[model samples]
Target: MSDFGRKGLGDQLKEKAQPDSTKSTLDQTKESASGLYDRAAGAVQPDQNKSATQQLGDSTRSTKDDASNQGQGILASAQETIGNAAQAVSDTLQGKK
Candidate 1:
């Protein structure tokens, strides 16, 4: 069977690893535009009216968005940890702590 409409494991991992800040300007714009389109389509064609494939697509998009958000949270936490470590080193060097 063809899984053409589905995201592969590698693609999902890549999406999770890539934070929005790292995306290029064009890529970010495209995502934003696509999101707008999806929202408009959803408003015009609610879930109850959507076909099985379309519903699956929406569900997949939601799951991907959630994963990306979680990944961003993890990335932010890592950055915070690194920043705190750097601050501690600076304080130690300055004899403040």
Candidate 2:
């Protein structure tokens, strides 16, 4: 057989482990958002001038904002992880290093 014909499927295949770049990046973003949310919540204090109902409304709004922000962060992080995993799989199948 010719040299080209003699080459097996293994000979043309190459693999290299893909390094993950998302972990630290995602962690930092999550941490930063958490810190920001905490600071925002902490900054809200009972106002002596405001009525009881107004105070309650302010507290409720702050809690809601914190929950909503945290939920969004979780969702975004999950999506990023899934996308990274998919990309890694695709790269591996293509014999990329």
Q: Encode model 1's per-residue lDDT on 3-93: one tens digit a residue.
A: 3333343454465578988999998787667556664664466677676666676677678779999999999999999999999999999
Best by TM-score: 1
- Lowest-scoring 10 consecutive residues by lDDT in candidate 1? 1-10
lDDT, model 1 = 0.69
Work out the TM-score per prediction: 0.62, 0.50
**Model 2 pairs whose backbones collide:** none
Over 4 Å off in model 2, which ranges? Answer: 1-46
| Candidate 1 segments whose C-alpha is farther than 4 A from its true place | 1-32, 43-45
Residue 77 Cα positional deviation in candidate 2, in Å, after optimal superposition: 0.9
All models, RMSD in angstroms: 7.5, 27.2
Candidate 1 TM-score, true structure as reference = 0.62
lDDT of 2: 0.54
Best by lDDT: 1
